[model samples]
Each structure stands twice: as structure tokens, then as C-alpha cells.
Target: MTEALAVPRIASPEERITSIIALASSVDGVDIVVAAHEGFTYSVQALNPEYEIYADELAAASAVYLESSWQKLTGNARVILADQGGKALLVADVGEGFTVAILGERQAVESLLDPVRRLATGAPISCPNCSAVLDVHTYTCPSCGKRIPFTATLCPYCGTASPARSCPNCGAELMLAPGRVEPAKAEKQRSAVAVTPRAQSNEGEVVSEEKGETPLLIRLTIGGGVVAAYYASSLLLGIDPVIATIVGAAPLAASLGLILTEKRRQ
Candidate 1:
């Protein structure tokens, strides 16, 4: 009775990833599951057994491309969903560079998004009032009294801003505002406002930048006319073809330089 107790074995990274893949694949409409860490494929599984041959390669390529794009697009994004050829592709970034990719029906993949996000972030989306797990996809709009997905910042049916929602479990008011604004998002918003057209005081008169340079269509037409005139002069007036070509290119070159300089200034 006093025998030594055996310690539980800890699962390896591969095992953990494999388990997560298996869990996702078990969902009804899930057809394939792939797990990767730091752009390296760890496991690949599919409902159809015949896909074993190229699954690993496909998973590796997908992980690399997705990881790169994810870093460039949004550093804090934990989940991404896309549809291609009627199949849904879901990529979840679990913490510490671990990622899981699942392919299945759109509805099924969307349902799994929150669960995967919870697993990766270790933070469940709970109701602010009652601490109940919130299902964003099944949110009920208070204004429209209709159930709809609350993926964006507004209720689609009534066009009401969703700063809060009623908790489905406890019927209590839950705040939908994010706890903190991300630096990148905040900066982007600020930049957008900064770039907005504004009136500037010039000699006590308001000046606006609304009037732009020559229209692109007119510029192109003028350039084409100049070039065509050069060619025509070379043919009809018997001017040296090489000299005509050089003279014709001068105006076009100047126009291009001005365009580039304007773009750089802007």
C-alpha cells in the first residue's frame, strides 16, 4: 500500500499538436486538420485517407505563407477564416508560434473559431456582466430582436453600434468594448484622421487642397499627341528619325518626372 506513485507523463509538443488537430478534425464537417509550429508542419490529418501523400507538403506551404501574412497584416490576430471553392479554411494561431489549420464547411469552421481562439489565448470571451462564455456568432441584437453573428462592431440588421450586448446566459448587460486599444490600430486611426482634407489659412483666406493637378486622362492624351507629332514630323517633314525620337521623348520624360515628384511629395 506504501508503494511509490508513478508520475504522469507530460505530452511532447508533437503530441500536443497532434491532439489539437485530432480534436478539430472530430468536428462534424471538418475534413482536414493540420498543425504547425514556427512555420514547420507537425501533423496532418484528413477524413479522407487518400490525402496522406501530399498533406504534409501542403500544410507546410500553407503555414509558412499564412504566418508571414499574419505577421504583416496584424500581429495580434489569433484567428483567420477564408473560403475557397466552397470549402472553408480556418487558421488559428495558438500562443508561442503554434498554429492549427482546419479545412471544412464554412459553418462548421466558423463555429470552431472561438474554441480555437480560447485554446490559443487562454482567455475565454466571457460576458462582462455574468462571466458566461459568449458565443459571438449567435449574438442576439437588442435593437432588431434578431439573432445574428456579431463579428463586426455593429449589428447588421438594425445598424446599431454594438458597444454592449445582453448576456444570453444571465440576461445581464455585457460590455462589448475591448479592454484596450491595440497600438497599431490606434495609430492607423490617427493617421486616417490626420490625412483628411482640411481648410488651411492662406493670407486670411481659407485654402483647400481639393483641386488636384491635371487629370491623368488629359495628361496621357497630351503625351500621346506630342509623341505622335514627333513621329509624324519625322515621316512627313523628313526630319532625322533619331533626332525626332529624342525630341519626342523629352516632353514625355518631363511629364513622368513631374508625376513622380508629385507622388513623392504627397
Candidate 2:
């Protein structure tokens, strides 16, 4: 009777970044998948946690710092190589206000770039055959051995259509934006070294940033008025030279004091 009442499960729950990285770990050369944003690591998706703890730490800091810094400079980095020593560092746009840092064999790790990109855009990946979850590690589905990549537009084995999408990073129809042209690539073409940010130990080292505008035209007008008054007092008024000098200086002093007062109030 219990067997008669049983029904098959429809599919796995919705896909997510955590599960995505778990699958990516199975890829032959992918070593680490970290979810990072704004100079902090939210999840060390996959790692050894021993030898890579230092690299991971550096990667996390640079991921957040360099990406944000680059955005401030170029309005977008499209992607950034934050830090690298034994491991290559990358911060690719994952959209949704977050990014994924993949550190491993540069070529192999890059293979999954499309996957991270899909996630950022809110279109998660799943197997075409059985609707099983998938990641870069999943070039071929275990559920049915159906070839995948989603970029292919249709599963060669299953004939299932790939979901249509508007890239979170680059809104191109089918092609990825070759990725917002890595910043270093531009410099390399121009003979420059846009290398990793130096990892230094200096408690006294200071990093600072500032943005705003000053009332330049106003200040210039104030100064011009003061100069005109100085000349008017000495040449036009024809009062006692000493008295005119003192009186002319008064307006200049008063104007400056008013300017300072206005700034302080703001």
C-alpha cells in the first residue's frame, strides 16, 4: 500500500552559488571558488585552508579593494586580477552586486568563467537531462552524460534548449563581452606594468581617498571685487591715503570672513 502511494521527486531544489562551487570543485584543475564583494570574502567556496590560507586572504583583500578601486577609476573593471603569486587572482563581474574569485590553473579556471557570470545575472544552471544542479566541473552531466555548458544553446545529447539571458556584465545577445577588456590589457598594449598591488607591512602606511567640488568661480569673483576696491580707494576716492588704505582693506577682510563662515556652516 505504501509503495502504491509513493511518487517520484520532480527535481533538485533551486540552484545556488554554494552548490555551484561544490560542483565546480570537481573540475580537473579548479582549486578555489570564493564569493567576495567590496574587499571581503563572504564564502571560501572551496580551498585547502592550509597553504592557500595566505593566498586566499590576499585574494580576498585585493578582490574587494582593487575591484572597487577600479570601478571608481573606470566606472567598471569588467574583471580584475587582484593579486597573484603562486595562484592567479581574478575578480569577474558576477552581477547582483557580488563577484566570484576563481584561483587556480588560469586556463582551466577560466573555463568556468561563464558559469559565475550566469549566476550574477540571476539565471542559475541545472542539468538539461534530469534538471540536476551543475557548475564548471560539470562539462558532462552524470545524470545522463549529456554534454553541457549552456552556452551551446542546446544540449547535444538531450536536445534541451539553453535558457536565454541578457548578460549581467555585458548585455550582448549570445557572445560574452570578451569581458570588459581587462584594464592591464590596455596598458600592456601601451607598455605599462599594471601588476598586483604590493603586499606590504607598514603600520604607518596610510591610504586615503577624497571626492567633492570647490566654489572656484565664487572665490575668484570675491578676489576680483577686493582688487577693484583697493584701486578705487587709492585712485578714485582721493581721501587721506592712510584712511583709504585702511577702509579698502576692511571690505576685503569682511568678504573673506563671510566666505569662511559660509564654508564652515556647510
User: Best lDDT goes to which candidate?
Assistant: 1
Clashing pairs in 2: 39-64, 94-120
TM-score of each: 0.37, 0.37
lDDT of 1 by residue, 145-167 (tens): 64444323455445777655545
Error of 2 at 116 (Å): 1.6
Q: On a 0 to 1 TM-score scale, where does candidate 2 land against the true structure?
A: 0.37
Q: Compared with the true structure, what per-residue lDDT tens digits does model 2 show for residues 43-131?
A: 66555555346444744565555446443212232455444566655555443344556676554455555555544343444333333
lDDT of 2: 0.47
Candidate 2 off by > 4 Å: 1-16, 55-59, 62-83, 93-97, 124-137, 140-266
Q: Residue 191's C-alpha lDDT in candidate 2?
A: 48
lDDT of 1 at 30: 67
